[model samples]
Target: MGFHTFDIDRADALEDESRYRHLSAEELLAVLRPHPEMTVADLGSGTGFYTDDVAPHVGHLYAVDVQEAMHDIYREKGFPETVETVVADVASLPFDDGALDAAFSTMTYHEFAGEASLAELSRVLRPGGRFVVVDWTATGAGTAGPPTDERYSVGEAASALENAGFSVDRAESRTETFLCVASV
Candidate 1:
Protein backbone atom coordinates (compact mmCIF):
# COMPACT_ATOMS: atom_id res chain seq x y z
CA MET A 1 0.00 0.00 0.00
CA GLY A 2 1.05 3.62 -0.52
CA PHE A 3 1.63 6.19 2.20
CA HIS A 4 -0.74 8.90 3.42
CA THR A 5 -2.05 11.62 1.13
CA PHE A 6 -0.32 14.96 1.34
CA ASP A 7 -1.77 17.47 3.81
CA ILE A 8 -3.96 19.96 1.97
CA ASP A 9 -2.61 22.85 4.03
CA ARG A 10 0.84 22.18 2.63
CA ALA A 11 -0.46 22.59 -0.91
CA ASP A 12 1.33 25.91 -1.10
CA ALA A 13 4.67 24.19 -0.62
CA LEU A 14 4.02 22.14 -3.74
CA GLU A 15 4.26 25.31 -5.83
CA ASP A 16 7.84 25.94 -4.73
CA GLU A 17 10.19 26.28 -7.68
CA SER A 18 13.04 24.78 -5.71
CA ARG A 19 11.32 21.38 -6.03
CA TYR A 20 12.86 21.23 -9.51
CA ARG A 21 16.05 20.23 -7.76
CA HIS A 22 14.51 16.79 -7.17
CA LEU A 23 12.89 16.33 -10.58
CA SER A 24 13.39 18.94 -13.28
CA ALA A 25 10.77 19.58 -15.91
CA GLU A 26 13.40 19.08 -18.61
CA GLU A 27 14.27 15.62 -17.36
CA LEU A 28 10.61 14.65 -17.18
CA LEU A 29 9.88 15.95 -20.70
CA ALA A 30 12.92 14.11 -22.02
CA VAL A 31 11.71 10.88 -20.47
CA LEU A 32 8.18 11.32 -21.81
CA ARG A 33 9.21 12.79 -25.15
CA PRO A 34 5.66 14.05 -25.52
CA HIS A 35 4.52 15.27 -28.93
CA PRO A 36 2.00 18.00 -29.63
CA GLU A 37 -0.47 15.36 -30.77
CA MET A 38 -0.03 12.97 -27.88
CA THR A 39 -2.60 12.70 -25.11
CA VAL A 40 -1.20 12.54 -21.59
CA ALA A 41 -2.07 12.76 -17.92
CA ASP A 42 -0.29 14.26 -14.98
CA LEU A 43 -1.13 11.73 -12.30
CA GLY A 44 -1.57 13.29 -8.85
CA SER A 45 -1.10 16.71 -10.39
CA GLY A 46 -1.21 18.90 -7.30
CA THR A 47 -1.38 22.61 -8.00
CA GLY A 48 -0.71 21.69 -11.64
CA PHE A 49 2.93 22.54 -11.23
CA TYR A 50 4.52 20.10 -13.67
CA THR A 51 1.18 19.69 -15.38
CA ASP A 52 1.49 23.23 -16.74
CA ASP A 53 4.94 22.46 -18.07
CA VAL A 54 3.61 19.46 -20.00
CA ALA A 55 0.24 20.85 -21.16
CA PRO A 56 1.45 22.90 -24.13
CA HIS A 57 3.53 19.97 -25.35
CA VAL A 58 0.73 17.45 -25.49
CA GLY A 59 -2.56 17.32 -27.36
CA HIS A 60 -4.54 17.05 -24.12
CA LEU A 61 -3.36 17.02 -20.54
CA TYR A 62 -5.41 15.65 -17.65
CA ALA A 63 -4.54 17.11 -14.29
CA VAL A 64 -5.66 14.14 -12.18
CA ASP A 65 -5.75 14.37 -8.42
CA VAL A 66 -7.67 12.61 -5.69
CA GLN A 67 -8.14 15.87 -3.87
CA GLU A 68 -10.57 18.34 -5.41
CA ALA A 69 -9.00 21.03 -3.26
CA MET A 70 -5.79 20.54 -5.16
CA HIS A 71 -7.66 21.14 -8.38
CA ASP A 72 -9.17 24.21 -6.76
CA ILE A 73 -5.67 25.47 -6.04
CA TYR A 74 -4.73 24.77 -9.66
CA ARG A 75 -7.77 26.70 -10.85
CA GLU A 76 -6.65 29.72 -8.87
CA LYS A 77 -3.28 29.58 -10.61
CA GLY A 78 -4.86 29.15 -14.07
CA PHE A 79 -5.00 26.13 -16.38
CA PRO A 80 -3.76 25.74 -19.93
CA GLU A 81 -6.43 25.56 -22.60
CA THR A 82 -5.66 21.95 -23.30
CA VAL A 83 -5.51 20.93 -19.67
CA GLU A 84 -8.53 19.50 -17.84
CA THR A 85 -8.80 18.76 -14.16
CA VAL A 86 -9.99 15.25 -13.28
CA VAL A 87 -10.89 14.35 -9.73
CA ALA A 88 -10.00 10.69 -9.52
CA ASP A 89 -7.73 8.18 -7.89
CA VAL A 90 -4.95 6.45 -9.77
CA ALA A 91 -6.36 3.08 -8.70
CA SER A 92 -9.72 3.86 -10.27
CA LEU A 93 -9.37 6.26 -13.18
CA PRO A 94 -12.33 7.40 -15.26
CA PHE A 95 -10.56 7.05 -18.62
CA ASP A 96 -11.46 4.36 -21.11
CA ASP A 97 -9.17 1.54 -22.12
CA GLY A 98 -6.17 2.74 -24.14
CA ALA A 99 -7.24 6.33 -23.76
CA LEU A 100 -3.87 7.88 -23.03
CA ASP A 101 -0.76 8.08 -25.14
CA ALA A 102 1.39 8.67 -22.09
CA ALA A 103 1.32 9.57 -18.39
CA PHE A 104 3.82 10.91 -15.87
CA SER A 105 4.01 11.64 -12.18
CA THR A 106 6.45 13.94 -10.42
CA MET A 107 7.38 12.91 -6.89
CA THR A 108 4.03 11.20 -6.51
CA TYR A 109 4.78 7.55 -7.19
CA HIS A 110 5.01 6.64 -3.54
CA GLU A 111 1.62 8.03 -2.68
CA PHE A 112 -0.19 5.92 -5.27
CA ALA A 113 2.06 2.92 -5.87
CA GLY A 114 0.16 -0.32 -5.87
CA GLU A 115 -1.05 -3.15 -8.10
CA ALA A 116 -4.49 -1.63 -8.62
CA SER A 117 -3.11 1.74 -9.64
CA LEU A 118 -0.56 0.16 -11.97
CA ALA A 119 -3.24 -1.97 -13.58
CA GLU A 120 -5.46 1.07 -14.04
CA LEU A 121 -2.59 2.92 -15.65
CA SER A 122 -1.91 -0.03 -17.94
CA ARG A 123 -5.57 -0.16 -18.87
CA VAL A 124 -5.70 3.54 -19.78
CA LEU A 125 -2.55 3.66 -21.86
CA ARG A 126 -2.47 2.28 -25.40
CA PRO A 127 0.10 -0.22 -26.48
CA GLY A 128 3.59 1.33 -26.53
CA GLY A 129 2.38 4.23 -24.40
CA ARG A 130 4.89 5.69 -22.01
CA PHE A 131 4.66 6.05 -18.23
CA VAL A 132 7.31 8.14 -16.56
CA VAL A 133 7.72 8.17 -12.77
CA VAL A 134 10.05 10.33 -10.72
CA ASP A 135 10.01 10.08 -6.95
CA TRP A 136 12.15 10.22 -3.85
CA THR A 137 13.87 6.85 -3.42
CA ALA A 138 13.84 4.67 -0.32
CA THR A 139 17.61 4.75 -0.28
CA GLY A 140 17.74 8.52 -0.03
CA ALA A 141 19.25 10.48 2.86
CA GLY A 142 15.78 11.63 4.03
CA THR A 143 16.86 15.27 3.90
CA ALA A 144 13.87 16.10 1.74
CA GLY A 145 10.45 14.76 0.74
CA PRO A 146 8.84 11.91 2.67
CA PRO A 147 10.40 9.61 5.17
CA THR A 148 12.78 7.05 3.65
CA ASP A 149 10.82 4.19 5.20
CA GLU A 150 7.72 5.15 3.26
CA ARG A 151 9.44 5.15 -0.12
CA TYR A 152 10.30 2.48 -2.64
CA SER A 153 13.66 1.70 -4.19
CA VAL A 154 14.05 1.87 -7.95
CA GLY A 155 14.33 -1.90 -8.15
CA GLU A 156 11.09 -2.33 -6.23
CA ALA A 157 9.29 0.13 -8.46
CA ALA A 158 10.66 -1.55 -11.57
CA SER A 159 9.45 -4.90 -10.36
CA ALA A 160 6.01 -3.48 -9.67
CA LEU A 161 5.75 -2.09 -13.21
CA GLU A 162 7.00 -5.34 -14.67
CA ASN A 163 4.36 -7.23 -12.75
CA ALA A 164 1.77 -4.89 -14.23
CA GLY A 165 2.90 -5.96 -17.73
CA PHE A 166 4.84 -2.78 -18.46
CA SER A 167 8.18 -2.94 -20.24
CA VAL A 168 10.58 -0.79 -18.28
CA ASP A 169 12.86 0.85 -20.81
CA ARG A 170 14.77 3.22 -18.57
CA ALA A 171 15.41 3.28 -14.83
CA GLU A 172 17.91 5.36 -12.89
CA SER A 173 18.50 5.93 -9.18
CA ARG A 174 19.87 9.38 -8.49
CA THR A 175 21.23 10.86 -5.27
CA GLU A 176 17.80 11.33 -3.71
CA THR A 177 15.29 10.08 -6.24
CA PHE A 178 14.53 7.45 -8.89
CA LEU A 179 13.33 7.85 -12.47
CA CYS A 180 11.56 4.97 -14.18
CA VAL A 181 10.21 5.01 -17.71
CA ALA A 182 7.94 2.18 -18.77
CA SER A 183 5.74 1.34 -21.74
CA VAL A 184 2.65 -0.82 -22.03
Candidate 2:
Protein backbone atom coordinates (compact mmCIF):
# COMPACT_ATOMS: atom_id res chain seq x y z
CA MET A 1 0.00 0.00 0.00
CA GLY A 2 2.57 2.57 -0.95
CA PHE A 3 4.90 3.95 -3.62
CA HIS A 4 2.58 6.69 -4.72
CA THR A 5 4.89 9.61 -4.64
CA PHE A 6 5.20 11.93 -7.58
CA ASP A 7 7.08 15.18 -7.85
CA ILE A 8 7.74 16.55 -11.28
CA ASP A 9 5.34 19.28 -10.47
CA ARG A 10 2.79 16.74 -9.38
CA ALA A 11 3.59 14.67 -12.39
CA ASP A 12 3.30 17.65 -14.60
CA ALA A 13 0.01 18.38 -12.92
CA LEU A 14 -1.42 14.97 -13.59
CA GLU A 15 -0.49 15.53 -17.17
CA ASP A 16 -2.45 18.70 -17.46
CA GLU A 17 -5.79 17.51 -16.24
CA SER A 18 -7.92 14.51 -16.97
CA ARG A 19 -4.74 12.61 -17.63
CA TYR A 20 -4.09 14.45 -20.85
CA ARG A 21 -7.75 14.62 -21.54
CA HIS A 22 -8.31 10.91 -21.89
CA LEU A 23 -6.82 10.15 -25.28
CA SER A 24 -8.20 10.63 -28.74
CA ALA A 25 -5.45 12.52 -30.33
CA GLU A 26 -7.48 12.10 -33.41
CA GLU A 27 -8.11 8.56 -32.34
CA LEU A 28 -4.46 7.95 -31.80
CA LEU A 29 -3.69 9.32 -35.18
CA ALA A 30 -6.17 6.94 -36.67
CA VAL A 31 -4.42 4.05 -35.05
CA LEU A 32 -1.07 5.31 -36.13
CA ARG A 33 -1.41 5.30 -39.83
CA PRO A 34 1.64 7.44 -39.52
CA HIS A 35 4.21 7.73 -42.26
CA PRO A 36 5.52 11.08 -43.02
CA GLU A 37 8.91 9.44 -42.81
CA MET A 38 8.33 7.62 -39.54
CA THR A 39 10.47 7.40 -36.47
CA VAL A 40 8.11 7.50 -33.53
CA ALA A 41 8.55 6.69 -29.89
CA ASP A 42 6.61 7.99 -26.94
CA LEU A 43 7.07 5.66 -24.00
CA GLY A 44 5.55 7.38 -21.00
CA SER A 45 5.85 10.67 -22.77
CA GLY A 46 3.71 12.66 -20.37
CA THR A 47 2.91 16.37 -20.46
CA GLY A 48 3.61 16.69 -24.14
CA PHE A 49 0.25 15.16 -24.89
CA TYR A 50 1.17 12.51 -27.39
CA THR A 51 4.28 14.41 -28.16
CA ASP A 52 2.55 17.42 -29.51
CA ASP A 53 0.20 15.50 -31.72
CA VAL A 54 2.88 12.99 -32.49
CA ALA A 55 5.17 15.70 -33.69
CA PRO A 56 3.36 16.61 -36.86
CA HIS A 57 3.05 13.02 -37.90
CA VAL A 58 6.48 11.68 -37.16
CA GLY A 59 9.70 12.10 -38.95
CA HIS A 60 11.18 11.85 -35.50
CA LEU A 61 9.87 11.76 -31.99
CA TYR A 62 11.42 10.20 -28.92
CA ALA A 63 9.71 11.92 -26.15
CA VAL A 64 10.67 9.14 -23.73
CA ASP A 65 10.63 10.05 -20.03
CA VAL A 66 12.02 9.53 -16.61
CA GLN A 67 10.78 13.03 -16.05
CA GLU A 68 13.12 15.90 -15.79
CA ALA A 69 9.89 17.56 -14.97
CA MET A 70 8.68 15.98 -18.17
CA HIS A 71 11.51 17.67 -19.95
CA ASP A 72 10.48 20.90 -18.40
CA ILE A 73 7.06 20.43 -19.86
CA TYR A 74 8.57 20.08 -23.30
CA ARG A 75 10.59 23.17 -22.69
CA GLU A 76 7.70 25.21 -21.43
CA LYS A 77 5.53 24.23 -24.32
CA GLY A 78 7.40 25.16 -27.44
CA PHE A 79 7.79 21.90 -29.24
CA PRO A 80 7.53 21.77 -33.01
CA GLU A 81 10.39 20.39 -35.06
CA THR A 82 9.87 16.68 -34.71
CA VAL A 83 10.54 16.72 -30.97
CA GLU A 84 13.36 15.06 -28.99
CA THR A 85 12.79 15.35 -25.27
CA VAL A 86 14.51 12.33 -23.84
CA VAL A 87 14.90 11.73 -20.13
CA ALA A 88 14.06 8.06 -20.67
CA ASP A 89 13.69 4.84 -18.71
CA VAL A 90 10.42 3.23 -19.41
CA ALA A 91 12.42 0.42 -17.84
CA SER A 92 15.41 1.26 -19.99
CA LEU A 93 15.13 2.59 -23.49
CA PRO A 94 17.62 4.87 -25.10
CA PHE A 95 17.26 3.96 -28.78
CA ASP A 96 18.97 2.33 -31.79
CA ASP A 97 19.12 -1.26 -32.95
CA GLY A 98 16.55 -1.06 -35.58
CA ALA A 99 16.01 2.46 -34.41
CA LEU A 100 12.27 2.81 -34.07
CA ASP A 101 9.76 3.46 -36.77
CA ALA A 102 6.90 3.25 -34.40
CA ALA A 103 6.23 2.93 -30.72
CA PHE A 104 3.75 4.32 -28.30
CA SER A 105 2.26 4.25 -24.85
CA THR A 106 -0.73 6.03 -23.56
CA MET A 107 -2.08 5.81 -20.07
CA THR A 108 1.52 4.77 -19.69
CA TYR A 109 1.32 1.00 -19.68
CA HIS A 110 -0.19 0.69 -16.26
CA GLU A 111 2.83 2.22 -14.67
CA PHE A 112 5.02 -0.63 -15.82
CA ALA A 113 6.67 -3.49 -13.91
CA GLY A 114 5.87 -6.41 -16.10
CA GLU A 115 8.98 -8.02 -17.40
CA ALA A 116 10.74 -4.74 -17.20
CA SER A 117 8.42 -2.84 -19.45
CA LEU A 118 8.28 -5.87 -21.69
CA ALA A 119 11.99 -5.80 -22.05
CA GLU A 120 11.93 -2.17 -22.79
CA LEU A 121 9.26 -2.75 -25.37
CA SER A 122 11.36 -5.43 -26.99
CA ARG A 123 14.43 -3.35 -27.14
CA VAL A 124 13.26 -0.34 -29.06
CA LEU A 125 11.28 -1.98 -31.85
CA ARG A 126 11.84 -1.88 -35.66
CA PRO A 127 12.21 -5.44 -36.80
CA GLY A 128 8.79 -4.88 -38.17
CA GLY A 129 8.00 -1.72 -36.25
CA ARG A 130 4.74 -1.03 -34.48
CA PHE A 131 3.86 -1.37 -30.81
CA VAL A 132 0.95 0.83 -29.86
CA VAL A 133 -0.21 -0.47 -26.42
CA VAL A 134 -2.41 1.78 -24.41
CA ASP A 135 -3.61 0.74 -20.95
CA TRP A 136 -6.01 0.89 -17.97
CA THR A 137 -8.91 -1.52 -18.21
CA ALA A 138 -9.40 -4.11 -15.54
CA THR A 139 -12.95 -2.84 -14.97
CA GLY A 140 -13.20 -3.94 -11.34
CA ALA A 141 -10.90 -5.03 -8.57
CA GLY A 142 -9.88 -1.49 -8.15
CA THR A 143 -11.47 -0.77 -11.44
CA ALA A 144 -8.54 -0.13 -13.74
CA GLY A 145 -7.31 2.37 -11.27
CA PRO A 146 -3.71 2.75 -10.34
CA PRO A 147 -2.43 1.68 -6.90
CA THR A 148 -4.35 -1.49 -7.30
CA ASP A 149 -1.12 -3.31 -7.79
CA GLU A 150 -0.36 -0.68 -10.32
CA ARG A 151 -3.18 -1.96 -12.50
CA TYR A 152 -2.84 -3.94 -15.74
CA SER A 153 -4.77 -6.16 -18.00
CA VAL A 154 -5.57 -6.70 -21.67
CA GLY A 155 -4.50 -10.17 -20.84
CA GLU A 156 -1.70 -8.90 -18.77
CA ALA A 157 -0.53 -6.63 -21.51
CA ALA A 158 -0.83 -9.14 -24.26
CA SER A 159 0.99 -11.71 -22.25
CA ALA A 160 3.69 -9.25 -21.49
CA LEU A 161 4.08 -8.48 -25.14
CA GLU A 162 4.26 -12.11 -26.07
CA ASN A 163 7.00 -12.78 -23.60
CA ALA A 164 8.97 -9.81 -24.76
CA GLY A 165 9.64 -10.61 -28.38
CA PHE A 166 6.39 -9.04 -29.47
CA SER A 167 4.37 -10.33 -32.34
CA VAL A 168 0.95 -10.20 -30.86
CA ASP A 169 -1.13 -7.70 -32.72
CA ARG A 170 -4.58 -6.26 -32.16
CA ALA A 171 -5.96 -6.50 -28.63
CA GLU A 172 -8.54 -3.77 -28.28
CA SER A 173 -10.46 -3.86 -25.03
CA ARG A 174 -11.20 -0.26 -25.60
CA THR A 175 -13.58 2.32 -24.11
CA GLU A 176 -12.09 2.47 -20.67
CA THR A 177 -8.85 1.71 -22.45
CA PHE A 178 -6.70 -1.26 -23.41
CA LEU A 179 -5.67 -1.20 -26.98
CA CYS A 180 -2.79 -3.00 -28.56
CA VAL A 181 -0.78 -3.61 -31.67
CA ALA A 182 2.57 -5.18 -31.86
CA SER A 183 5.37 -6.48 -34.03
CA VAL A 184 9.13 -6.70 -33.86
> Which tens-of-lDDT digit does each residue in 29-65 have in candidate 2?
8777787799898877766777787789878888887
Best model per lDDT: 1
**Candidate 2 segments exceeding 4 Å error:** 1-9, 13-37, 41-44, 48-58, 62-72, 75-80, 84-100, 110-127, 132-145, 153-155, 159-166, 169-181
* Candidate 1 TM-score, C-alpha based: 0.98
Residue-pair clashes per candidate: 0, 0
Clashing pairs in 1: none
- Candidate 1 weakest ten by summed lDDT: 1-10
Candidate 1 error regions (>4 Å) = none
Q: What is the C-alpha lDDT of each candidate?
A: 0.94, 0.73
lDDT by residue (91-141, candidate 1, tens digit) is: 999999999999999889999999999999999999999999999999999
TM-scores across all candidates? 0.98, 0.32
Clashes of 1: 0
